[model samples]
Target: MNSLVLFLLTVVAFGSCLKLPSSFKKCDRKTTDFNQCLSEAIYGALRILDKPLPSHGLPSLYGVEFPDVFTMGNSTYGLLQKFYQTRYIGLSKPENINAKLDFGPLTITLTIEATYSQLTVETEFEAQGTIVLLPVNVITPVVYTLVNPTYTFTFVLEEYEKGTTYFRVIDSKIDAQTQGLKFDYKGLFSNKVLNEEFNNAMDEKWRQIWILFKSFDEVLFAPLFGTIFNDFLKKVPAAELVDG
Candidate 1:
């Protein structure tokens, strides 16, 4: 999740400097068909962002690396977990991508939604805890393959200036729905059979488990997203993004 957020920030921060090819479309906020145009523009941009734009200081989305380690403290949540060296692929290939922008009298609301045919996440984890009262002592490779997952991000932005027009997210929400999930774990229970069974059970109940922890995930992600977004906005004048 954290790596996903970082990928977005990387795009926005460097995207401002892109001397987009003439084929890339631009939408004027003043047009009555602005939202539709913006959606198309976003879709076109996604198709081309897989490659690095070094002249614009942007790395390829396909090969982005995440080196930070994350620790989830002990809690009733049932997992004392730490994960690091994670990598994800297939972010630049979202289907049915759309973006909507509503500039109200008091706030600017932006929503982006997309579905991925398959998103693969690989990471190493160390966990020492209990789930369903069963001991969990494992340090191994874990792979999550999300099939046909749709993700939506909505932000209510407030305008501000740091020598230029910029916006900061004052409120935000993120939601995801997946058609299917596949989980791979090694040495989960010190028994291959138990591991396979546990993985299957988790895949079957992935949505329910995500819902149980969604709020906690939001608490950890929202502020970090806001901060990174604000930094990105600082690089490009708000007027250039939308002239209202």
Candidate 2:
């Protein structure tokens, strides 16, 4: 899920009570070049995540945590994957990026496209049943990589009035592309040969496996990010974050 790291951009706005860090740039909506400025502002903010901004409700990018346990099963792959206690590293390293913000009559939409050459996710996992006829049963440290993966995310915002106008996420879409995928499980089938073979197959059939779980992004990630972003937006009115 290389695109998983990109969600930080969607949650960039902070509460009005918290001052924007000097290093953070603001792109006023009234500016003629606001679209490009917004993109640069977002790309620049990625570098600031090396440390947490507690007052601003932002966490460090080096180790963003996903604590809740979640499960997803696919009949096509015959695999049930469960994950919990997951943490991600290397989020601040997005490359070849393009972020665009569009303000419509009734919505503000943000679309971000970026490629991650290397993003690491460490998680405790349990896989029951087989994938593509391969037997598997594992509950161990799982480290996965999606080589040179590019992600696109679109967020639709709706304005509401609470004394002042504020924007909240009403819908979102997540998309990703990758050259290949690799998984390194510490103890799969309890045999070194079997583990290597399984990984080799994964590398070869990465796209198919990725597609098999594409629904997970829509079912889980989109809503999860929308909720987090909306929480932050709740405290910051639209007029405060961007000039109208």
Measured by TM-score, the strongest candidate is 2
**Model 1's TM-score against the true structure:** 0.73
Report the number of clashing residue pairs per model: 0, 0
Summing lDDT over every window of 10 consecutive residues in candidate 2, give the lowest-scoring window. 9-18
As for candidate 1, its clashing pairs are none
Candidate 1: segments with Cα more than 4 A from true spot: 1-24, 51-79, 130-136, 162-164, 213-217
Please give, for residues 149-236, the per-residue lDDT of candidate 2 as tens digits: 7778788999886545777899988887777678887777777897788778777877787885456556666676666567667776
Q: Could you tell me which residue pairs clash in candidate 2?
A: none
Per-residue error (Å), model 1, residue 93: 1.2
Error of 2 at 169 (Å): 1.4
Minimum summed lDDT over a 10-residue window in model 1 is located at: 55-64
RMSD values, in order shown: 9.0, 9.3
- Tell me the lDDT of model 2 at 72: 80
Candidate 2 accuracy as TM-score: 0.80
Predicted candidate 1 versus true structure: per-residue lDDT over 1-244, tens digit per residue: 9998878876765555433456557778888989988888867766776886544334555544566677876836687888777776776788787789988998999888878898777779898889788878778998888789886778899887544456777887777777876888876778889889989999888887667435533564455445545555555556656656
